[model samples]
Structure formats: structure tokens, C-alpha cells
Target: MPRTVAPARRHSARSRRLRLTAAFAVLVAVAGYLTVQYVTGGTSSDQCTVESADGSAGDGRTYRMSSEQAANAATISAVGTTRGMPERAVTIALATALQESGLRNIEHGDRDSLGLFQQRPSQGWGTEKQILDPVYSAGQFYEHLAEVPGYSRLPLTVAAQRVQRSGFPQAYAKHEPDAALLAAALTGRTPASLNCEPPRSTAGTGGMTKVRAALVRSFGKDVLPATDGAGAETPAAGAAAGALSVPVDTPLRSGKGGTAQRGWELAHWAVAQSEALGIDEVAYAGKTWESGSGWRTERKESGTTSIRIQLAR
Candidate 1:
């Protein structure tokens, strides 16, 4: 039988309305302002500030990264996961972002190309429709790339070349370090604390998971194969009892920490969305992301460490 929408939906709708109000208010202030570069394929002058997931560090100061860059990075990360690719895939993607687009995701670019990856329809990248879609372009890049045997073992450039076949092949190299930093953040190897200000109020909010599901539905699952290492975290997702295993009393951090249930909820969520969210791991409070695909404690950090959801797997 089809399950009915939970009564919680009504309450959730109300909470979402409130949160949207709050999120939009912040968006207006930060929208036109110069936001920091969260991470990207080009050199960045922005300095990073670390904050807990709830948004804070030692001081009361909030953390920051390029809201513009973060969206591009987040998009790539999500697309790669939707295709079931691994961090290496994100790394390669970063290289592509470096060469094609500076990860800014522009509407207009060299010639008729658009978006961060500068895909050109004149060059046979699907129609403007396909090229403009970051997820579609990324998936297309991966599809061609995976066909090149030993790509994972190839030098990043050689591997990238097999796919991009660009005129300026060497240009892709300069973006490596920048791409790596972004790969860490986008792939969840860094920290969620390294987040950007809210996006334009016009860009609706469903959070990462909701966005991910929509992307999967849009792109066929075959874009990423099961054998892809991207499936690494599936085990961890199952470790938790509920689909949304986050316990009822999960802790909420205000630069402090949440209860174990909250931490568990976060950990479970991290693993559950590892592939789709393009996150390799998540670290909150004392827990570390390490369940092959989920977080495993390597060494626990003690003290008033805020509950930071770092992407550094």
C-alpha cells in the first residue's frame, strides 16, 4: 500500500516556512556582497573560516567560503555522486572545472558556451539544454572518461584529456590544487562548516538530499555504474536502523555539541547520502566519518570542539 504523507508534513511545512523566512533574510544581505570562494579550479584570494555545522568556531565569528564557487562545487559533487563516481572522479571534475569554467558557473562564456564547464554546443556538447545543465555535463564527462581504460591510474591530465580533448591541454593542470581543495569540500572530505551564505531566495531550498533525489530522477541512473567506487558508503547507510536514522534527541550545536542521537543522525545522514551527496565522510563532535562509506572513529577529539560537519573524509 502507498504510505500516506506523515502528519509531520504539516509541522514540517510550518517549520520550513519559518526557516525560509530566516534563510531569505540572510540571503538579501549576502546576495550582492562579495562572498568568499568556498573552493574552485582557479587561484582564490579568499581566506577560509572554520565553523561548526551550526555555524561557529572558537570565537562567535561565522565561517565563510565563496557562495558562488560553493554552488558550482556543490553541483559538481552532487552530479558525480548521482553518477556514482568517487573522490578521484571529483578530482578529475575539478580539473575539468579548472579548464572549462573557473567554477563560477556563468550564464555566458567563450562563444555560446555557458556555465562553469564552458561546454559548447557548437562543439557537439548536447544542445544548449544539455550543456547548461551542470549535472548533465559532468555526467557526460564521466561517461566518456570511464570508457578510457586505466583512467584512474593515468596522470590527472592524461585522464582528463581522454575525456575533454581540449586545445589547451596543459591549461587544466593549473587548476589541480584549487580543484583538490574544492574536491575535499565538495566530496565531503573537508568540512560542512566551510559553507557559503544562503543562495538567492529565488533558488528554492530542499537541502542536499532533496536536491539529490531530484537530480537522480532527472538523469538516468546509468550515468554511473554500480561498479564505480562511488558505492563505498552504502554499507554505512545500512548501519543505522531508520532510513533517516537521526534519533529524536539528536544534539543541536550552537558551537557546542548535540546529544548522541543528533550526532548519530548526522553520521547516518552523511553515509546515507554519501554517494548522492558526493560526500566521502562527515565528522561531528568526537565522531569521525569512516565506515568504508560512513564515518569511523580514527581518533576522537576531546573538549569544547563544536559539532563541525567537515568534508575531509
Candidate 2:
């Protein structure tokens, strides 16, 4: 009186278990791939490149980042430049953001921390809304960094740690090279230096008004032409509804180059914002950068005193 199990039944159960285990392993692998894709903003093929326009191709220095990170980085640099902070400060801020949130305006982080800087609300960085605003968060970081004595002279890690008080203090050093490149291009120290190849799926229908508003928001209204009878055409009149021409009026100084540098800054900023604002073409300093096609030189009778941004219609 003992019950006997069939060999066929035992084999069938073992085969089913093996099949299930293999399926589960496949599922886990797919999930991990997807998570990484989401975190890195999909494939690495689409990227923003920052280089030295004046340097030889063999210079062997370039900074690459996702389009999203480039946008946030540009905003941070603009905030610092607009506030009259030096390029070094912008570099420090960019590095801090790179370490904290990878330059994404994230909504959640360790505990109640949020935004690009990962400032915690409980610690009075700001309320959730303020902390989430990249502009506000960048400003707050600068305000605190300025308080640190001789921050510019201190080692980057020491200076940033004084402001951020991050647990991993050494991490900031790793991002310095990329931060310097971004700071150079965004702060207008490099010409025709930053280019972004936005994903085709994210392109937007063009609007010049939004472009103008965005320029004001980042660089301040002073960057805009005076509305009252100035020699330059109004932002609305010089171009059609879908096109905008921004005049570069930063006064040229002896031995400091000419308006060309300022033109490049506005031009590069427009390119950086192309994805977010749905821009299609940006032309300045006799060079034009299309959404898909990188930068190219073109001769135009109109000269390089203003940057032309054409949005999709």
C-alpha cells in the first residue's frame, strides 16, 4: 500500500517549471533594459556635443550629454550669467546639478529632495513648487555658493561641498570636465561650440512668440531690443509669426573680440532650446544649425548682428 507516481507526470512537471523559470529570467532582463533606457533617456545615439570652436579637430576634448541634460545645463548657465556670476560659478553649479540629478528637473529624490539641485524642502531649500523650478533652484544655489569665502579659489569639490554638503563629496570632481565645457559654450566663451541632435519624435510646431518669451526668461529682458523706436526691428516685425530674429547688442570691447561672440551665445542658446521650443533652424555668424543636420557655414547678405531662429510652422 504505497501510492506510485508516473514517470511521465514527473517529467512533465519538471519541464513546466524549467520553462517558467526561463520565461521569468527573460522578463527580468527586458525590465532592466527598459529601466536603463528610461533613466538615460532612451538610446545613447541622440546626444548634445560641446566642443571648442576655435580648437583643432584633434584637440581631443569634447563633452557629450543628452538633450534634456543640455537644456537644464543651459538654463543653469544662463541664470548665473544673467546674475553676473563668473564662469567658474556656473561651472560649479553645473557640476553640482550633474551629480545631484543628472540635470533633470526630477520631482522625487532621497526623502523630500527635488529638482535639479535635489534641494530638500524640509531643510528649507524651498517648497516643492519652488524647488522644482530650475531657475529658482539654480538661483538659490548661487546665493549660497556666493556666501562661501573665496569659493572660486577653493578646490571645486570643497567649494561645492560647502554649499551642497553632499554625503559623497568626491563625486563632484568627476563632473568638472563636462561642466567646464558646458560653462564655456553656454557662457559665450566658445563660439559655434554647442550642438544638439534632438530626437525626431520630440519636434514641436514652431512659434516665435514662445521663443522670444523663453529668451527673456533665461537671459533677462535686457537681451531684447528696446521696444521704442530703436533702429533694430521689433522681434515681431523683422520676422513672420513663426520666425524670430534676436539682435546681438553686447558692446564690443577692444581686444575682447566683437559682437560675433555674443551672436554665437544667442545662436547656441537657441540651438540648445530647439527641442524644448520646437525650433527648426538657428542661423548666426554665417553658420546655420538645423534640427537634424548639425552646423554649416552659409554666406548671407544679412550679416551676423542678429540670430535667426525658425520654428516649425
Q: Which pairs of residues collide in candidate 2?
A: 206-312
Q: Following a full C-alpha superposition, what root-mean-square deviation does model 2 have from the true structure? A: 10.6
Candidate 2 lDDT, 1-313, residue by residue in tens: 9999899999999999999999998776556434432563434454788886545476747877777788888889878877877889999999999887878888866557688988989998989999998889999999999999999999999999999877668988999988988888987778778889887777765356677678888888777766656444465435665677787865321125357766776788888888888888888777889888888878674576788888865
User: How well is each residue in 1-313 modelled by candidate 1, as lDDT tens digits?
Assistant: 9978888998899999999999887675343221212223346533232243433355433423344455556667656644556667778887787566666665665446666666778878787877777677777777887788988778788888888776557777876766665555544444433422232332222343453354344334432113226642243222232222122131222112234422432343343333334443345655555323333444756322223322222
TM accuracy, model 1: 0.49
lDDT of 2 at 133: 86
**Number of the predicted model whose TM-score against the real structure is largest:** 2
